[model samples]
Target: MTTSDIDESVRAELDRLRSSIDNIDAAVVHMLAERFKCTQQVGHLKAQHHLPPADPAREARQIARLRQLAESAKLDPAFAEKLLNFIIAEVIRHHEQIADQPGERP
Candidate 1:
């Protein structure tokens, strides 16, 4: 169990896997940044048009779509839905703050 006891090959394999995981984590963060940029634009557009911050119908559709995609990807659908819901909540919060500002024009 200890690092000192593990075989050299096993240590190398663990290092390789950890490196790949680190790379994947970085990519996920970058992708999330891009996603938020798009959602920021959406928030501005909604704020400009006097629209509601949260769209339940669209959210439902998105959850369903993501669930299907999760199934296709062999990921847990419930976990994907939960993650999307959390992201949607954050996006809605951002939209609400954008809507509150009166002077900024989108």
Candidate 2:
């Protein structure tokens, strides 16, 4: 193939790859939104029961589980752990806010 033809082919492939990445990004955002909704309900329940916002044991278990899943998926376990940690921190922040509302014990 000519140099110009090769360049066009490369651009086409890159565009296709980027489109797929954009779709995957959208899906990830939607899934995270759903997860946060569920966690919000959990936060409300924890607040009602006067439970602590952060659960070390559960967090440990989740990290382990996600690491295993990342291994199975052939993704980087450290990246998975970091992502989960960020999400967990956000969730705990929401839970703490719930726990601070009026009539909450702590």
Candidate 3:
């Protein structure tokens, strides 16, 4: 094939790969939204029960479990841990907010 034809072929493949990545990104956002919705309810319950916003034991277990999963999937364990930490931080923030609201007691 000519050089110009090879360049066009490469561009086409890259575009296809990018399109798949975009779709995966959208799926990840939607999944996170769903997960946060569930966590919101948990936060409200915790607030009513006067439980602490952060659970260190659960967080530790989750980090370890996710790291294992990432390794098994051939992805970077550190990256997975960072992502989970970010999500956990947001969840704790929401829980704290719930706890601060008045009339949370049962």
Candidate 4:
């Protein structure tokens, strides 16, 4: 049913729930930023050590770990895997860029 067709009490509850969702979204963004910052450092380290930008074994292990965590959290494992895959792809890209810049600091 549409919010406009709902009563005041229901509308108020919906508003409250939406506000909580918004706050969670903000927190997620900040957490991601923190994660990326760490990943950037990892990229720099890998670059300096002449490591490959992508680590298939580590990526597989991480995906499995995240999927298990998602299952425990009652979230969709496939969805969580997709999200991590996206993030991993971006991280690999960043790492490749860092590797290309031989002497640049992150």
Candidate 5:
């Protein structure tokens, strides 16, 4: 193939890869939203039971699992850990917000 043809082929491949990544990004965002909704539910449950907003053990277990999955997926484990830490922090904040509202459960 000519040089220009090779370049065109590579560009087509990149475009295809980018489209796949975009789709994955959308799904990831949707999954995160669903997770946040579950966090809100947990906040309500905790408030009702007079439990603490943060669950250290649960968070630890979650991080551990994520790290293992990251390793298996050939991804950066540290990045996965950091990401999960950030997510857990957000969950804590959401829980605290719900807790602060009047008549909110545990």
Candidate 6:
């Protein structure tokens, strides 16, 4: 193929890959939002029960479960662990914020 033709092919493939990534990003954002919502509810429940804000043991369990799932899916366990850790941290922080707010019960 001519140089221009090869360049066009590569560009097309890159565009396709980008589109897929965009979809994945959207899904991740949606799932994170859902996670935060659930965590907020949990925070409320914990507040009502007069429990502490952080649940280190539960968080560790969740990380372990996520790591297992990633392994089963044939993905990189380390990458999965890191990503889940980040997400979990964010969720926990949001939960704590919700719990600490004066007006809210959780």
Among these predictions, the greatest TM-score belongs to: 1
RMSD list, candidates in order = 1.3, 3.4, 3.2, 2.1, 3.3, 3.0
Alpha carbon lDDT at 32, candidate 4: 96
Using lDDT as the measure, name the better of candidate 2 and candidate 3.
3
What residue pairs are clashing in model 6? 44-106, 99-106
Tens digit of per-residue lDDT, candidate 3, span 11-86: 8998899999999999999999999999999999999988999999999999999999999999999999999999
What is the C-alpha local distance difference test score of each model?
0.95, 0.94, 0.95, 0.94, 0.92, 0.82
Per-residue lDDT over 2-99 for candidate 2, one digit per residue giving the tens place of the 0 to 100 score: 65667877989988999999999999999999999999989888998988899999999999999999999999999999999999999999999988
Tally clashing residue pairs in candidate 4. Answer: 0
* Candidate 5 lDDT, 1-106, residue by residue in tens: 6656677779899889999999999999999999999989999998888888999999999999999999999999999999999999999998898888898852
Off by over 4 Å in 5: 1-6
Q: TM-score rank, highest first? A: 1, 4, 3, 5, 2, 6
Per-model TM-score, in order, reads 0.95, 0.88, 0.90, 0.92, 0.89, 0.81
Q: Which candidate order results from sorting by lDDT in descending order? A: 1, 3, 4, 2, 5, 6
Q: Name every residue pair that clashes in candidate 5.
A: 46-106, 47-105, 47-106, 48-105, 48-106
Which window of ten consecutive residues has the lowest lDDT sum in model 4?
Answer: 97-106
Candidate 1 per-residue C-alpha lDDT over 2-106 given as tens digits, one digit per residue, 9 for 90 to 100: 889999999999999999999999999999999999999999999888899999999999999999999999999999999999999999999999989986455
Give model 5 RMSD, 1 decimal.
3.3
For 1-106, candidate 4 gives per-residue lDDT tens digits of 8857899998899899999999999999999999999999998999878788999999999999999999999999999999999999999999999889958544
* Model 3 lDDT on a 0 to 1 scale: 0.95
